[model samples]
Target chain A: MPYTSDKPPLPETPEQLRVRIPGWGVDLDPADRPAVPRERFDPGATGAHWEFPERQPEERPRERSIEHGTLPPVFGTTLPLRGVSGVVRRYAYRRFSEARAAHWLLLMAGDRIDVVESRVLAAVRGRPDDPVAETGVRSEVSHHGWSSRAGAGRADVVHQPMDPVIVAGPWVLGGLAAVVVARRLARRARRR
Target chain B: MRAMVYRGPYRVRVEEKPPPRIEHPNDAIVRVELAAICGSDLHLYHGLMPDTRVGTTFGHEFIGVVEQVGPSVERVQVGDRVMVPFNVYCGSCYYCARGLYANCHNVNPNATAVGGIYGYSHTCGGYDGGQAELVRVPFADVGPAPIPDWMDAEDAVLLTDAVATGYFGAQLGDIVEGDVVVVFGAGPVGLAAAQSAWLMGAGRVIVVDHLEYRLAKARELAHAETYNFAEHRDVVVLLKRVTDHLGADVAIDAVGAEADGSLLQHVTAAKLKLQGGSPVALNWAIDSVRKGGTVSVVGAYGPIFSAVKFGDAVNKGLTLRMNQCHVKRQWPRLFEHVRNGYLRPRDIVTHRFPLEDIAEAYHVFSAKLDGCIKPLVVPGPA
Candidate 1:
């Protein structure tokens, strides 16, 4: 997935994929594709000087999609893979082709995991994320939060009921856990 | 010839490279005089875009003297000082005929969405950019226009992309007279959008950004109200309060890919690559606009999924208009604006670097060092 030459093997053979998924290769036939006629395959027409442009030296490992034969000539080294989220991202790139939904879904999951990791790290550094302020809860009251949505017939109105729970569920759970721990510590202190 | 070569992300160097030659009948080779680094170029610099080859030179906004022309080329000749539009398109293409040169289907192999752009990734058609001594422009007759004798060279260079794109952003907003417009990201594009909003008869224009220096530049250059988003507890709420709790009549997103409002969004999209771009500014634009108002997006984003609050736009009945600016389409009006002294695109230029020192230039620009707003690249002797 990151800094490797060999192509990753697909989880399933093409034949297996074809049978497992319905209409998996629907656009494989040129006849079925409307734009096939206009899609010209002319490499020389681009007038590039080199067959394969010179590869940039990789100072560190970099992410490459499984679909690519090798890393692109240049890649970002700013954000290196790290932590549990990194492991999830690595698994996605290594195990799935970009064409697969799993690859993208895993990457999205990794992003969510990264948020948790960041929150934990921030908490450890004594700069815990403020859910009330960061989440824009204060804006709701001050900036016509309910009235704006009440009769507006918004598309997101369908999920408006769930937004608060989705936003504050984890924070509520964390607060409850802290309260329980504090109570337990108090009880033990009294017993001593 | 010397060109800026992408060694890797955050790594570029000025290297000796062969000068570009006309490959197509409509191609023209232009000796670059002035080129400006675009905010979008930072996408390539940070390796956010896919298929950005190492040796690719990243510049789209450039003006130069034509050195050679292909046999079939017309409307332009050698020795003419021309500013090439960032778009490379065949004039006769369906999109070009409709004045949508940015969507011209013939130039780029991946022509489902955008047309060819110089010095962008292979996804945009692997034509080298103008951040070099020379650049080969395809469909030269259609794209490059002679710079007016009275026009400043620096102004012409900025028009190639930045100014044009900004003007286009405001135009797309469809601003009505006395409309309040809020522009997110006070970079060159945002500044231009802010200024152009006034031209479009906007009553009030507010520019938003975290950087105090850029906010000051917005005030000085665009003559618009400025807000340091970092100072506000919630910029969107502040926008609502300032706009009389109805939100701005129009909101323009000039920040793309690497927007820095929400730490979570920046980490997820810009850092983690889970989404194509950080949608903070775009989301802010969508949120800060009044119900039934328009939102214009000129910020460059990758051709991938972004966690945009699309449902909010639909619910708010917002008109979301966006595209890569059809650069030439906006020029006729812009030229007049420049001539009338209503706009001065080059006022944003804060730094200039010779082709040899582009890496330092990029570093200074990318890191936002020295209050650098816009940096111009001089290919000739500096």
Candidate 2:
């Protein structure tokens, strides 16, 4: 269904779709559309030599949305699905329609997981993320952070209390986990 | 062939790639001469856009010489220099017939909302971008236009997307004579919008940005008032105070997803990916535009939920207009403006990088280092 010169058959006939979904073909009538005259189906005019484009060789498994019949002729192979986040994203694409909020929310959740994964990876590589500096907390202190908010009457103030938790919550949890791991290791060594 | 390849977020490198070939009868293989790093490409570079797979090249603004054309290609020929619009649309589709080429339903199978775009994510149709030695351009006859004889190549390249999109933004505002127009983000698009606002008979135009260097560019290039939001306590309040408690007649959000006004919005959207885009600038546009005024959005946001002030917009009776630019639609007037010396799209170019050094170029542009404003990538010897 992806990148074929031949138009794919509709999943449902127009009459069936119209009956099942309201406003399914509101723009189907050429009489009502101004561009209808130019929308003539003239394949000869297109000059496409092939029935479908040659598919680029897939170097690895790629994410294809469930709604699509196959992978596009050419797809990005650079960031193949890997780790836990990739599994979640793959599930999102495999199970949900693009129109569903669940599809996007799952992707967002995957992105958050990716952030944590990257941070943990960085720590393992001896370049731990500096939460205070990287989180813009330093800028908040130095760059008119309080004065700008005091009299500005900004709408974002309602969510101000949660800012710290949202920004610093992961770092705090990570620190606690590290301390717990270190203490357990120390106790085990003493028993040995 | 060599091209810029995406390794991951904040990681891109020049790598040897297979030279693109004619994929369809309407396709043409273009030997890229010049490509630009658009502000929106940063969205892909930052991993902000969904489905931005690694190994995908990220470029949309480019100009090149046609190396080979499919048999059916009539208008464009081999050896002709061409400037391709970022939009890949079948010109006969319903949307294209109405000159809304950006929304052409035929080109992209992935999304119904927008036509295919070069070098953007799979969402825009997974067409490879032009930041390479060679690019395969589909719908070649419809999308690639012969550069005017008198036009500079730099100008031609910029016109492909950045300049045209900016001009389109101003045109969308429908600026009347003596209208006070405010533009957010002094990137190439914002600068072009400010300049185009004047051409459309704006009485006054103002540009907002946190960078002093870009604000300086806005003043020198667009000849408009500039405001460093970093210097102001509240930029919206400042706009209201300057406008005598009313707001500008039109406000344009040229700054898309990664706007830096609010710490929360930036962290949540840019960092956490909870929202598709940070709506700080859009909210500012809604709040800063006078009641019943127009808020024109030329900024590119992902197809996801953004925390915009929709209720406020409805209450204020504002006309909100936005679209991916119909690039070729604005070319006639832009060509005239360029010939008349009313606009110079190439003056914004601050750095040029060869294809090999593109990694450094993206780093400089992304980090906003060395006062870099607009950077162009020059693919090697033809």
Candidate 3:
């Protein structure tokens, strides 16, 4: 089976959830009064007036297994490079270029591959345990935002929003240098 | 145009909703003529199915006159009367090729668990059903079959889900020439299954239900022995006693999650929604069948885990078979039966309500009121 369903439901607001999951049959307030008497029916009588299901709706057993989907957050970050005479710059360029190329390929393919550990896989598989239970993100983010997870007990699963300019600068410089190098080689070949 | 929108648990209202339009190339829009509130629809109405969103329409068993058709729709056309199978199966899939239309792989985005089911919440492909003025049918040619010229609209609609499911339940029992079959629940599906059991050559058939009206219907319609579980001190013990303590050769559970058994279990599971559903009828079916007997389950239940007697079933060496019925596969044989006067599928419909008054129809069916054995919905003036 696919780890997680590709189709996630539309976001259900609290307003909708309040009425739906409460398990109360619209008894809090009768939305509409029945024009016909709420009289019981006789098994043999064929003429019980039904004025459109104006009554409140209730839930029954759903045969299929569609549950609330919890998706791992997808966010991006950037890395800054400090280079003397573009030495480290060239090294960072190769590494970051690989990452950009991979990103481009996935975008072209119009699909995403989620690679997580078995623990995270449990949530995707719709099994009992979930990734959120393994890691408490809400409380961790509230106090320090991104720095708390980096503290003593946990040193992983940090969320730091990085400026895209850092990666964009080196990428642009590398592209310009490549273009210059290509032009010179082309000119030399033409002269030869 | 009005559709029965499910707002919350046990709360249904008819609201003006925009009719469906063709969203895919193989899709066809059917202006629903005759629809039925299926027993399984109660599951959605009660909020047992997960991800059953509000604004979801609930009828899966419906017949309609085709209003519009996408370019790729070939089998059904505009103005044609068609009875759509509850399953929205793509014809060319690994499962569909093997005639397992209910397990078709290429339809539902969530194909891992269930195939496409119309109006059956998001878990079953999230396809909208034919309960409204217009419904979009996917893979239209494969799923919707033309109504046999001589068939009644009521019979055709029932075949879309309940009748087909009941017959499939009997077929899964693998009934032999003289096998005794005990069917739990005398609802439309149970009645149909008991009747179908006879066609499958079962020598003796017994129908069990808590309702007097339904048990009486079973006695009259299927000509089978009837047992009122409400009357028996122990229904399972009584089944064993009546079957010479060997139990019946086959037992079919036609009652799904909402079945009543013990008060505590029913309160927690069916009422509280703690577990899937009170596994009362299913457990009884398991216990009532003979050792090494076949157990066929057609009753609809929530996908969540339930406290079932799996250990006992394994120890008894019983063969268990179940699925959402593959409706198209049973159509040919059912058509023959209907034509030959062997089965009057339409005779079960006890009440009919306009699409405008579906809430009352649902209430009548859900409450099992006024001997509403099977209630059919009239969508438009047809």
TM-score: which candidate is best? 2
The TM-score obtained for chain B by all candidates, in the order given, is 0.99, 0.98, 0.98
Interface RMSD of each: 21.0, 15.4, 25.2
Window of ten residues with lowest summed lDDT in model 2 chain B: B105-114
TM-score of chain A of 3: 0.18
Best by lDDT: 2
- Please give, for residues B195-290, the per-residue lDDT of candidate 2 as tens digits: 877766666688988877788899888767888787788999998877666788899999999888888887788667778899999999999888
Query: Model 1 Cα RMSD, Å?
Result: 19.0
Q: Which scores greater on TM-score, model 2 or model 3?
A: 2
Docking class of 1: incorrect
- What value of lDDT does candidate 2 attain over all alpha carbons? 0.75
lDDT of 1 by residue, B1-382 (tens): 8998765455567767877765666678999999999999988776667545556788999999999997767678999999999987665544555567787665554224557889986556667898999888876767899999999999999999998889888878877656778999889999988888776666677999977778889888786788877777898899877776778888999999989878777766655556789999999999989889999999999766889999999999999988898887678777877887778988989888888777677766765655678999999878
Q: Model 3: runs farther than 4 Å from truth?
A: A1-192
